[model samples]
Target: PMYFFLANFSFLEICYASTTLPRMLMNLGTQRRRISLVACATQMCFVLMFGVAECLLLAVMAYDRYVAICNPLNYPLVMNHRVCIQLVTGSWTTGIPFLIEYTYQIFSLSFCGSNQINHFFCDVFPILKLACGDTFVNEMLAYMVAVLFGMVPFLLILGSYSKLISIILKLPSVTSQAKAFSTCSSHLMVVILFFGSAIITYLRPNTRHSEGTGKVLSLFYTILTPMFNPMIYSLRN
Candidate 1:
């Protein structure tokens, strides 16, 4: 079950990185920084889709580890093939409706002034700043979405890990405890890196000083985390 979840996560990381890096690299190579509204919207949709899916998938992985370590007898029964597939499907599809509406709301607004996006990618706050009209509602909605998809899943992962740690500590032998912790250490590193960067990027105040900081932080989750995931898991092996 762990490997299964990791494989899905690896695939998700590929998709997530592809959503932004190719375009970013092209712009850097050709010096054509301009992006059409349609293209921007498309990028936003995929970025949101894959980003939200990853948050949910990581939570699911945490839950899988909790089940395996805390309920060894029931792990196979609980995390059966059908159940795993359903969880993956739910992770992938859960945020699509909300994200579609969120993307639409962002793009529907007027952008009469300079269309220059402050960031490398067409992220929510960067695009919001470009809109000529009032963006108070959009900002609030973005916050709500971040709390729902980003923070909520993070909390879930934390809860699962809390239980896992308690169970691991209760194990009789040091070797057994080490084994249990080993199963989760890679995932914990990933969760911290990915969610830490994401929370800082989305949940914080967007200010002129922080725009540059946010772009750099965005690279952690969007580019660096994905790049590190395979290495982290493989090193665990």
Candidate 2:
């Protein structure tokens, strides 16, 4: 059952990466990097939706790990087939509303400044930069959505890991501890890679780094992390 969930997760990562990575790479290589308004809006919507799905999926995986570690005897009862289906379904669908919200807010603003996005792809913050009028409303909505999708799932991940770590520490055997740490460490690393880059990209203050740094961090989370997640799980598990 857990393997099935993981397989589903890997599929999500593939879709997530496919949403933006290919276009980003192609844009970088080609001279004609112009994306139409509709295409740009569609790109932003899918990218944000997939990115949110990934975050929620990671949180779901953390809960799975927590159940397996802390409630091994009741793992089957707690994480039954129906519950697994629900979790996956919710993770996949939770982003649809946000997709509409983000896409609408972004395109609503007047791109009176240069339409040239600073980043390789049409991301929220970069797109926000092109808006001519007051972006206070847009920025506020973006941050609010970020908190809902980003910070909430992150806090859940942290809570799950905290409880899992406590359970792991109580184990008496060194071999058991080592094995547990090995499994948890891989997930933790990927979580850090995904959430850390995301926080930097979305939540962090703008002055912390140059625009180039922001784009690099965006690439890390949106492209590199998804590409490497399956590898991390395969190699580390």
Candidate 3:
């Protein structure tokens, strides 16, 4: 069950990474930063979908680990194939409405200003900057979405880890403690890497002073995290 979840996550990371990074690279190489409105909207849609799915999936994965580690006796029945399918389906489906709404909000804005996006892709902040109209509502909506998808999942992960570590610590054997730590270390690293970057990018106060930092953090979460996820999992195994 754990391996199954990991496989799905690995695949998701690849798809998520592929959604933006390839087009970004192409745009950079060609030095053609001009992307059609439809194309840019489409890219943002996929990126948002995959990114939200990943957030939910990571939380689910953490719950799976908690079940496996903290309740080994019931793990098999609790995380059976049907349940696994449901969880995966839920993860994939949870972001659809959000994606549609966010895309609509972004595309509906009047981009009367410069068309050139500063970043490699049509990310929310960069695209938001191009809008000539007051973007307070959109910015608020984006922050709400970020809190829903980003902070909530992070709290879930932290909660699960807290319970898991507490349970592991109660065990008498040092070997058992080490084993538990080994099992969770990679996931913990990933959670930190992902949430750290995401929180920095999305949850931080929107100000001109932080634009450069936001872009760097966005690149880390969108590009670097996905690229390294498979490597992290492989190394752990």
Best by TM-score: 1
Measured with C-alpha atoms, the lDDT of residue 229 in candidate 3 is 83
How high is the lDDT of residue 170 in model 3? 98
lDDT of 2 at 108: 80
Across 113-193, the per-residue lDDT of candidate 2 in tens digits comes to 697888878888888888898888787887877889999999999999999999899999989988878867777888999
Off by over 4 Å in 2: 207-209
Clashes of each: 0, 0, 0
TM-score of each: 0.99, 0.95, 0.97
lDDT of 1 by residue, 43-160 (tens): 9999999999999999999999999999999989999999999999999999999999999999999989988998889999999988999999999999998999999999999999
lDDT of each: 0.94, 0.85, 0.88
67 Cα displacement, candidate 1 (Å): 0.4
All candidates: CA RMSD (Å): 0.7, 1.5, 1.0
For model 2, which pairs clash?
A: none
TM-score of 3: 0.97
Candidate 3 segments exceeding 4 Å error = none
